[model samples]
Target: MLVLTRRRGQAICIGDNIRIVVTRIEDGQVRLGIESSDNVTILREELLETVKQANQSALSSAPEAFNHWLNQQPKAVDDAGNTKDKA
Candidate 1:
């Protein structure tokens, strides 16, 4: 991983479009403001892991049965750019 030091209001770029700016530092928590495309999605690590577990549970509940049920539902995009069924 690339490591760099940045203060509040300082920013970093990812690829061509995404920009992450350090907005504030308080109690060791850093607040960030993201300037990027609307299509871009981001999620915290723990939340991402939770979503993965949920998806695995959903998929494992049943194989053919779950697949059939999932196929019938409309897909929704989650905060992490993942598609999830509303069911």
Candidate 2:
């Protein structure tokens, strides 16, 4: 990580389009203002981590969920496209 000391109102530039500026500092918390193109995505680290964990959990349980759904579905067709008796 490239660490730099920047005071309030100081700004940092990334590449040619992104800029981060320190907006406020109080109570040991720092607030920043970020400028970027409309296509760029900006997310907090914790929010990104939460999304990753939720996605992983969903993927891990997908097979079981699919199986449960399949079992609940009506078994109306056979492998050869023949309709099976409902009884």
Candidate 3:
């Protein structure tokens, strides 16, 4: 990774479409303001992980496969003559 120092209101450029600006520095935390094109996506770690997991799951399985897996699970019965899963 490239390392550089930027004070408040200063910015670092990444090519022509992206920029990172130093917005705040306090409590040992450095805040950055990102400037990017509309097509670019920037997300927090957990959000990124969710997106990746969703994409991977979609790619690795089909609707039919999921339905088959669901069918294999044990069914439930209730005293009211309804499936236990039914409300």
Candidate 4:
């Protein structure tokens, strides 16, 4: 981890398009402003970890759920070569 000290209004640049600016410092809290392209995704570390765990849990259950859905789908082939439900 690269750590640096910056006073208010000081900024750091990452790569060619991202910038992290120190906006304010208060009692034990530091506020930062981030500027980047719209394609960039910025997330807090804890929030990112939570999202990763949720994705893993969903993926683990997906196979069983998909198989159950496939079993319930009708095995009829339509003229367009697509699976269709029997009426």
Candidate 5:
């Protein structure tokens, strides 16, 4: 990690399009302002981790839930292999 001391209004540039600026400092808390393109996604670390965990949980449960749903559907064939279509 690159660490630098920046006072209020100081700015740092990343690549060609992204910029991070120190906006305010008060009571040992620092506020930052970021500038980037419209396509860029900016997320807090804790919020990003929460989203990752939620995605993992959803993926883990998906197969079992899908199988259960499939089992509940009406069968398209009979035990003798004949098509069971309602006329």
Candidate 6:
């Protein structure tokens, strides 16, 4: 990681189309303003991690959920694809 020190109102440029400006610094917090092309996707690290964890959890439980659903379904057909009578 490249680290640089910049006071408020200073800016940093990345590549040709990205710019990050130090907009505010107060109460030990530094705020940045980023300018980028419309096609670029910017996301916070914590939110991205949360989404990944949720997706992993859902995937882990999918097979159990599917089995529960399959058990609840009506046995309307046999292995040969013939309809089975409930009676």
By TM-score, who's the top model here? 4
| Alpha-carbon runs more than 4 Å astray in model 3 | 65-87
On TM-score, the stronger of 3 and 6 is 3
| lDDT values, one for every candidate | 0.90, 0.93, 0.87, 0.94, 0.92, 0.90
Query: In candidate 5, what residue range of length 10 has the lowest lDDT sum?
Result: 78-87
List the candidate 2 regions with Cα displacement exceeding 4 Å. 70-87
Give the TM-score ranking, best first. Answer: 4, 5, 2, 1, 3, 6
Give one digit per residue, the lDDT tens place, for model 4 in 7-73. Answer: 9999999999999999999999999999999999999999999999999999999999988987887
Clash pairs (backbone) in predicted model 6: none
lDDT of 2 by residue, 1-87 (tens): 999999999999999999999999999999999999999989999999999999999999999998888777786888899976554
Clashing pairs in 1: none
Q: What is candidate 5's lDDT per residue for 1-87, written digit by digit as tens?
A: 999999999999999999999999999899999999999999999999999999999999999998888777776787889866432
- Candidate 6 local Cα displacement, residue 53, angstroms: 2.3
Q: Model 1: runs farther than 4 Å from truth?
A: 62-87
lDDT for residue 55 in candidate 5, whole number 0-100 = 97
Candidate 5 Cα deviation (angstroms), residue 22: 0.7
Question: What is the total number of backbone clashes in candidate 3?
Answer: 0
Worst 10 residues of 3 by lDDT: 78-87
Which of candidates 1 and 2 reaches a greater lDDT? 2
lDDT, candidate 3, at 53: 96
The positional error of residue 30 in candidate 2, measured at the CA in angstroms, is 1.1
* TM-score of candidate 6 versus the correct structure, residues matched by position: 0.61
Number of the candidate with higher TM-score, 4 or 6: 4
